[model samples]
Target: MASQNRVDLDGNPIKPITICMIGAGGFIGSHLCEKLMAETPHKVLALDVYNDKIKHLLEPDSLPWADRIQFHRLNIKNDSRLESLVRMADLTINLAAICTPADYNTRPLDTIYSNFIDAIPVVKYCSGNNKRLIHFSTCEVYGKTIGSFLPKDSPLRQDPAYYVLSEDASPCIFGPIEKQRWSYACAKQLIERLIYAEGAENGMDFTIVRPFNWIGPRMDFIPGIDGPSEGVPRVLACFSNNLLRHEPLKLVDGGQSQRTFIYIKDAIEAVLLMIENPARANGHIFNVGNPNNEVTVKQLAEMMTKVYAKVSGEPLLETPTIDISSEEFYGVGYDDSDKRIPDMTIINKQLGWNPKTSLWDLLESTLTYQHRTYAEAVKQATSKPAAS
Candidate 1:
């Protein structure tokens, strides 16, 4: 394999390359577009179906490096448009997909067709053009790890020597394929396979990153089924909002399920690192997250309550208790595994990258943001008096 660290002769660092990022409208991609434009030598063409959320970043004088980025309101499912965007750049990062569990559960067929089927053409295009492909995968593919600590064993041969885990350390899968929740995992796993095969068969330069539960600003924050999924709002945002508002921090099943989180910025850094080096990263996979950032639902509620009380001048919200009797909330084939954490030795050893932020830092920032937004929303809603 070529040296993972490919340096130019002068060693002064090459100018940032050009990049086209698909799905740039979503939470992660939007942040990544800005980060790349400001920090890397690469200029960016950000393409997504025009959405207000992403358009917020495109406002004049909003993004410090806005000139370095060209925004395209194109859909990834459109092959011709996608092809044009892919061919114009040196690297293409695809983040478009039904990312949340609830969203995927509600629209499995659509998710499969759009993200899986639609992405194949882009993969093929990148292969033909010899442009590097950076595709997003999820830790959900691991299913569930049975143990408290991650097992040390790993089957991934291309992983950096220092990053490999033992046999028992890889992620675990639960129940069976019949469960609807597994559809997300199934799709993600299939994409990983496809990327691996494309790299081996067609000489496509591909990098796969499976990120754990990463939460921060811009995360979907509403509660209920129509709310985000894989437990997005329920886990972080809900707890934060309730705590801030002095409402109950509802818990399902005593909040026992455990998960690890990495800040969005750290996740973005790992993706960029992979895109920069194809020789070492091509056909390789890495888990991007902070191992130190594990927290259970019960623990999260408590933490949010504590943080809110400490930060806000108002009295902390009363912690309302909820019964764990609902089987639908935490039944078999519904939510699997009690804990999930990544063994970071691989990415750290190979790319010299590791998640830098703590979960508290992410949570605090999220809480502050939510408080501000919610406060504004309340002001707007209450400003108008009720009609007789």
Candidate 2:
């Protein structure tokens, strides 16, 4: 659709605007950039240290939207260029953070600094310059459900009111300080509070997005191929790597933790609505996820195993998954959220947005892409002679 034909929720025609998208090379950022370029007429000043994931969109100046998207190679942490970038754009979207679960406990200090301290300047710049800000927070900020504290045999644990995470109602619960896994959540919560305060005190136009496990192609890198051989990515990439190598997916702590995943394409639609309709989105925290797509990690593993077999035409392994303790997988001081089902009332009432993809359907398409993109590389890598 052309920009002229685009209409806001209130039936107002949308105007083209430049967006300063920090961390535009990351998974969510890449998808947002693609959406903005392909579906909307907005220009993006894409800032990130690396552009490998978005390289497809950046090159070949002859591309239709070439002039609309420009990549700036700079880190937001200390770059003198950040403030000017924010001032030049009509809106700013901050997506930079150390978000992987592996880093939350193992690199707690870095996680805290990246999620909170580094983001302070972005919030400050947006507030000071009167630029609208869209900050991407995590569902991890909800920590654990209240029902998780109930007795295992308690019937109340089955109630959705006790377990469902609400943007406006739920409490942010975290484990003891020794459990460094909450570092990321703590930092994010603090930053969220700061942003909220800025809005309440200074009337800054802002929207906070809490994503619940948005997964799809071009997510985190596959180990030993694009990322470090020892690097541990999020669950999707982790399982995808295991499947590509024909190895058993390692389920951490019996994989009892439950998660709700929304397909990236579906989640991006909600974001676009938030972007184009600031009247409905400003001063709101939206939980963008598919609540109906909830699954236990073990269940997710099994589904992925089945889907990968179908996509790659490979036989299913007799033992598709192996259980590993949290200490062995994520190191010491690790904790996990028992369940995360976002209360969709706020987002639905405000933006009228809902996720549409099913878990199995998303997994089928995602696994197919994974197998096509990496199976050959994995085969050659494993077939190589060991260095003597």
Backbone clashes in candidate 1 total: 15
All candidates' TM-scores? Answer: 0.82, 0.99
Q: Enumerate clash totals for all models, in the order shown.
A: 15, 0
Clashing pairs in 2: none
TM-score of 1: 0.82
- Candidate 1: what lDDT? 0.69
Q: Which tens-of-lDDT digit does each residue in 1-388 have in candidate 2? A: 4455878999999999999999999999999998998888899999999999899999899888999999999988889999999999999999999999999999999999999999999999999999999999999999999999999999999999999999999999999999999999999999999999999999999999999999999999999998999999999999999999989999999999999999999999999999999999999999999999999999999999998899899999789999999999999999999999999999999989888999999999999999889999999999999999
Worst 10-residue lDDT window for candidate 2 reads 1-10
lDDT of 1 by residue, 1-388 (tens): 1132445333434446778887887778878876665566567888887545566657776666667678888766754777877898988888877775544555668867766887788788898888888888777777765443334564532243323222225644655655666677777778788888888888888888788887777765554222333454435666655554456876776777777778888888887677666655667788888878878877777777766665565576654545453245434435555566677767876678888898778777777776766655544544667778
Give the Cα error of residue 264 in candidate 2, in Å.
Answer: 0.3
- lDDT for 2 in candidate 2 is 41
> Candidate 2's error at 152, in angstroms?
0.6
